[model samples]
Target: MSSARPDIVVAIDGPSGSGKSSTSRGVASRLGLRYLDTGAQFRAVTHWMLSHDVDLADPDAIAARAAEPQLQSGTDPLQPTITVDGEDVSVAIRGEAVTAAVSPVSAVPEVRARLLDLQRRIIGDGGIVVEGRDIGSVVAPDADVKVYLTADAAARAARRAAEEGGSDLAATQASLASRDQIDSGRATAPLVLADGAVHLDSTYLSLDEVIDKIVSLVP
Candidate 1:
């Protein structure tokens, strides 16, 4: 399904701390396109789950109430926002508790389906840089430009640790590895490079370099 609008849709997929969030935002802002953080959408749901005392392992319960929460995501490239049921969950979703529980919440087929639909709706308006683990592969397969970003585990962990306020490198590495396993092994919408996507390893590349490469690829 192609958009009727003239805006270009850029799909970016990558693991955590690979600069997907920052790069997408920067690229979109510079190019005048909207930005979407699909990961934050998942975190919003996970935050709701924890708030409501829902069992993270119960797929049926998650699926049944998947549409219960009111999720609204701002696509402004300068300052994106994600709210759940009128609460600003931008910061709360990134906490240790939400981070530890997001995987299980996101792994559910029901949760993925619900969020995927929301993502598509947002993109359908056109002109968005959607970043997530499976956006290029599953969320917007026909995206105008698809980019798969990656970096060394150590680098990724270091970036994540810094953002989380001096996290243990060892623990950060283990957490990233575990998240990779869960994200890539999940039965529904596993993380995989989309066909024709431009692969980029950000381990040695500056954020500007990555953004420049993507901007160059825009059609």
Candidate 2:
């Protein structure tokens, strides 16, 4: 018998400030597909752990309760939303505090284990653009299309600073570098160019250009 039609999971992985979110959203919206910002899910969970007074340094403690928060991700690419325990945290999760805390929170094997199923569930019947640091490699290895978005450190920093309406460029670059180091070094599902995933560098490309490139890959 012929194998099942592969789910159209457009997995886009990238380091922080690499235009993964924008490209994924644009591609999803243009194609009328669901959008899943897996990174935002991680942020929401990390924010929950912080609010609950969980020790950020204690991986075991964090892991033991990783499933406590109810994370809900809105799939509309036009307006993807993330909430924890029914609380809207789309803005809260983007703050520097959450930014700094998310890397470690995500590094916990238990946390990944908990979110993995939820992510897959959200992608059910899978016609979606899922963006994260490891989506292609772990979350949906058989995704019909996979792209690893990236850019130079300077370019990535500038993009992030622009998003923040002008932050210190140096600081933003430093933070991105730090986050990249942590993410790449993490033992569980480290950021990587998934096997067979096409690498797209958005450093010099407009968002539309990058989105079109990904869309063209959708066969």
Model number with the top lDDT? 2
lDDT of 2 by residue, 1-219 (tens): 112234678899999899999888888877778889999999999999989999999999999899899988999988888889899999999988899899999999999999999998988888888999989999999999999999999999999999988999999999999999999999999999999999998989998899889888887
Error of 1 at 90 (Å): 0.7
User: What TM-score number comes out for model 1?
Assistant: 0.96
Off by over 4 Å in 1: 1-5
- TM-scores, one per candidate: 0.96, 0.96
Can you give the lDDT of residue 157 in candidate 1? 98
For model 2, the superposed segments whose C-alpha errors exceed 4 Å read: 1-6
* Clashes within 3 Å, all models in order: 0, 0
Question: How do the residues 78-158 of candidate 1 rate in per-residue lDDT, one tens digit apiece?
Answer: 889999999999999999999998988899888898888899999985788899999888999888899999999999999
